[model samples]
Target chain A: MVHSIDQYVDVVGAPVVEQLRRLGERLKDIRVVHVNSTREGGGVAEILYWMVPLMNDLGLKASWEVIHGDEGFFGVTKSIHNGLQGYPVQLKKKDWDHYEEINLKNREHLLPVLEEADIVVIHDPQPAALLQMIPNRRGIWIWRAHIDVSRPHHQVWKSLKQYVQDYDASIFSLTSFAQILPHEQFIIAPSIDPLSEKNMPLNKRYVNEIAKAYNLDRSRPLIVQISRFDRFKDPLGVIEAYRITRKVIPIQLVLAGGGATDDPEGKEILDEVYKAAGDDPDIHVLLLPPDAHRQINALQRLADIVIQKSIREGFGLTVTEGLWKGKPVIGGDVGGIRLQVISHYTGYLVNSPEGAAHRIRYLLHHRAKMREMGKTAKEFARENFLLTRQIREYLTLYLYLLKDRGRSVFV
Target chain B: MDMDTVPFYIKDCTLLIKMSGFSPAFDIRDLRERIAQCSPSVIYHHYFENLLAPTFDYPDFRNDFAVWVKRQLDDDVLAERLGMIEPYRFDSLEDLRTHTLDIIDERLSELHFITAVPPGHEFYFQEAITVVFETGHVMNNPGEMFKIMPQLTSSSIYYHFLEARRRTPDLTDDFSLWLENFGSEWEPLIRDLRSIDFIFYSLPELKEELLYIMQQYEVKE
Candidate 1:
């Protein structure tokens, strides 16, 4: 038999990792699989990538799979994403048929692997339709939704939920996202791995080198935020804030990020961002490749201040990444931003570019107080937002769902 | 038993005209209050007939007949809403049967409907609704509402007695004999109400039955 997840308590934390170890002692080698939309981008993908390995480290047979879709499929899914998030999307008959057809294709390739797994967790709208494919799966199929569906557009939500209802259980990121579906729902917010290369402390030399290479001046204060060039992330607004703060404390704004494989509208949004920043040398918009984690880490480290001025954010990982690096963050007051940036304590939650600019100027000018705030932010994240804590929450949910299946695997 | 169902009274207005012995070609179309001029019973009877009629004379009205019939007579608790609501709504009339069946395939969609709102609100309708906390709550049999709000004084026909006595020149000496004769006469038309295979041709006939119920409860002077 495999050893318990308690093997990870020292590496991660004692409370949850140790409990996982005890649970693992009893429920050893239980096969669990996760299926999600993208392999490289989005919070779900990033979390599952690290989570699967740690779960395996904890002695469970955990594996991960990513669903593949082409441009047409991605378009339909992006609309479905908006619909599920409460944006109005009028879906025609052909749209519904196209959604099922793509699911059928993915099923053709991925069906055999999913069916054999003990428990399959389908991630978001992309993999939700996989349930209709495996009618005879001997294991429990759980759906994991990580978007804000607190007030979803009815027509699309109802149509998409048609597929989700069949799963044995469902998991949501927040309480507001839970709908009146027949199955059970559990809340599991995402987390960042402290030990990962992206999060672990970086060398001062490397941070300085990246800043110099990116044409950044070390004499002036630095403000940075790393996110995709999408409307949801509000890259253009971030530029506006940098322009606003230039009047108070002259700091360079590094808008460093790139598009994911799943997003089709990235190029169009990128064009809009370029036009808005039009020939501004101080506004450094580095469209890095998808695998630019180390560059991102260095940018966060070099920054005297970090800001996530999003119009609407879906749990900004960049915010947590900044906080973990001991930088005071000024973020927008929406979605998971509220959860991350504790007002006047961890960082200030502002509404507009002017507001973000105001906070950025204040933080950049006050170096000593900013460092103290950064320390507070880091401790806040260490206590709450670590990957080990996230894994424990999930393990507990599994044991809870486990109670219905014949016998108690855990007390 | 009461001669009429509550839904039958609420819906059937046309047949009430014939029962009032008003001429069919009565050139009273110009009168503004003419439809309401007929007693509520006459309105109730016609509403039922139009609803139950297998074939409707007007094109806009054809889809209505089946739904109205199912409301009054279908024994299945979720009858009209199950099949009728999806088909007749604005978008689905394209391929008729196919489109209707596609929508009918859905077992549960959020039950979105209109409700009266308070005076100051600008919305023409409000989304005030609650999911039935109890199963079979919608299927209260024989036209009875499964639950009634005690604070509101308005009563229900299937659970509460009708209060008016029709001064029928043809009123029978005894109520039981009248009910038995009416039930027997209408047996051929009395849609097993349970095995409701066909829409009733006359929906307002229930108002005549309501007169039978009202005969039991005389309103005190």
Candidate 2:
């Protein structure tokens, strides 16, 4: 659903909307381009869905360009992603060669649009090397590394760092994930669109309908974990936690997530999740489509407890989504999840299935504590993790980078 | 890692004092006498001696090094110069001594280098060196010196404390004790750790991880 900045004025407040308008005035006529691996399925694409239009409405010539690549290209990028998140993945010489080869091919198709833009924001490792491939690129290029690189495998960081060190600046989700880059680094946590289809208020009737449609037993306290079926998301761990929690509390589990177009590892992980949930009637695994935003919203709203037990994460947008819906989230203690899920305040962070199950039982047993945490989670998300705050940071970065390079923001 | 031998020069004084507080095994008494004979104030004081255990004693090497120089050696100029020497900035005693000698080289010859090991206590020097250079004074040593030297090494205290934490992950009191005094590293890590990753580390494993970082950014006295 399309949303105007005015709609969020009441939700976020008049001050935030006014701030964006002022920033937009300084960024007027700026040709901003956001290039990433995919246009749908993933959080980056989902964010750009609203961010681009909002930027345009604010009077900037904002555009999003999706990069084209094949299975081999995505495979290499996925390995790079894993390596950046501190999982050791050895990229063979051909892996690096194949990555460069695909970007070079994409560069030919994207050069004209990329070079003409006043600012180009390349998201994650998939399109990081694009800057070097494009010729005479007349723009302030920023590499947005969306993975946790606090303890990156040395060889992998050595490879990725060379490609990104010369960019105008790098942006990470947290200060710990930041590297010793020559260029300045900024910490901008990813945000959820509070006014989007995935986050908008849904009626209890609609939520019940969606729950019935999914064959979920809402009578029992429902525990839902909504995320892509990725290994790093640790679908198995969530299942283990659910199984352990079910031993004491009569709770139902919903592992609902869709595969992103660019990610090739989804089916394998989905199958693993299926094997993990074998013959378990209490476990409801819903493989929703990319457009199942309302369903996701309803699931989050209906959930008694929301869990995102990712082993590694760039930033769990679903965690923010859960928090925004006033659900106390049990999230993995990694990446941007640490920034959102304040332990014992918003929700407890768990490391293992046993820990998750323990917290699950504690929260379920203590209804009042659960409700208090949920209330705090909602307010915390409102203050920090909303889309308007994200847009403000992006615009501010553009203005600062432009002014640093001797370009006048007023002009 | 580097070795050089220099001769001792005295300012016409034979008065010598023992440098105490190091492990009784280390020949610090002979070393201090050699140093004090040259100049009472120019004697080297180990950064560990002033540090209080269970509670970290802040490093005050400059003032302590100068007190000996001013009060004992009676050379105010040399005392002030020694006071100005920020030994805390150097990683090893060798580096600090070299830096100090360079500053006072025009005045003193080369004060004789004492190994700080007492007679018949050559084994303790080897043990101390092993702890300092090999295990970072936190691992594999069963000696009283190793147990007591964590505060002296600065980073070793954290390494040892983290090791204790790893051995008994459920011991909240031990973790709390470490957190109370040396929280600069643990608090940030704990605050930022994903809940799962926070529980993921066994105390020993966390120590090794912290030890790697401490090696890179060693806590100097």
Model 1 root-mean-square deviation: 22.5
lDDT tens digits by residue: candidate 1, A199-263: 77688898889988999999988888888877777888888888887876677888888778888
Model 2 CA deviation exceeding 4 Å by range = A405-411, B1-221
After superposing candidate 1, which stretches have Cα over 4 Å from the reference? A1-16, A405-410, B1-221
lDDT of 2 by residue, B166-206 (tens): 23445322323333344365454333221223222332234
How well does candidate 2 reproduce the true complex, by DockQ?
0.01
Which prediction has the highest TM-score against the true structure? 2
lDDT of 2 by residue, A1-411 (tens): 555687788787764575566667777999999999887898899988999999998889989988888998998898888788778899998999998888888898889989999999999988888989876989999888777787788888899887898888778776556777877666677888987889999988999898888788867899999999988899899899998888778899999998887888899999988998999888988899999899999999989999999888888899999988888889987777866777778888888999889989989988898898888778767756788778876876776677643211222
Whole-model lDDT for model 1 versus the true structure?
A: 0.60
* Candidate 1 chain B least-lDDT 10 residues: B124-133
For residue A159, model 1's alpha carbon misses the true position, in angstroms, by 1.6
